[model samples]
Target: METITENQKVRAAKKLKKMFGHVDLRDTSLICPIRDVMAVASDKWSILIVLYLGYFPVLRFNELKKKVYGISNKVLSERLKHLEGDGYLKRTMYPEVPVRVEYKLTDFGHSYLQKLIELTEWAETHKNCVISNRTSYHGS
Candidate 1:
């Protein structure tokens, strides 16, 4: 993988600060672009669901529930509904004997997937540093 430039790191830091600069531990408002994006993107199940959808072009509800692992039916259902409502997922219901349904990514979801891949890559590169930092913090 290609290396991330210093400029990109600085820009990301600035953006994160801007997103969280308000410093509210109790609640958040969707007042800024960064907050709006992070609000949904940083949710517990959102990234996992998006990743699974990215990996599989299309999947049924049961398949998603099984693949995500440890996600309850209720949580999975809620997350799917939330994601679909947010325009990240496209749900298609087929007129069949038993009524088949499938879920896939919308164009916006695909774009978000690309950003996630980049973030994952950045994490991989800095993983050792992160581990060292955690160890130092805990060991001291």
Candidate 2:
């Protein structure tokens, strides 16, 4: 990690202490809702899935699996189901000789994906600095 100077540490401590106010560390009731919302897209697979759907208007299950490498079927299925359940995606099943299913982002999901795109760009900008910080912190 980029080492924080004593001055920075003191300033951060003061800000955190003031922000805590009367709330105990164990009392996370206030931030729980926001945390819960963020938890949905807090994983690699979920973020990739969102990005994929954003780029492609629609995609098949197998195509998604292929694009997001190393993701197990079970995990992909769970992610899709959860995203769909959370109103982030639309699942369409076609009645055919066998069966066909497609997934696409809803309007709300598209909006979220746009935000994620911004986050991705920000990360790309800081990626080198973050890697350097990690390497120095680990001393490896």
Consecutive 10-residue window with the lowest summed lDDT within model 2: 16-25
Please name the candidate that would achieve the greatest TM-score relative to the true structure.
Answer: 2
Give the Å shift of residue 136 in candidate 1.
1.0
The digit string of per-residue lDDT tens for model 1 on 53-74 reads 9999999999998899899999
Model 1 worst lDDT run, 10 consecutive residues: 25-34
Local distance difference test scores for all models: 0.87, 0.91
- In candidate 2, what are the lDDT values of residues 1-115, reduced to their tens digit? 2577999999998988786765666878976765787888668899999999999899999999999999999999999998999899999999986799999999989989989
Q: What TM-score fits each model? A: 0.76, 0.79
Those runs of model 1 whose alpha carbons end farther than 4 Å from true positions after fitting are 1-37
TM-score between model 1 and native: 0.76
Q: Give the TM-score of candidate 2.
A: 0.79
lDDT of 1 at 16: 80
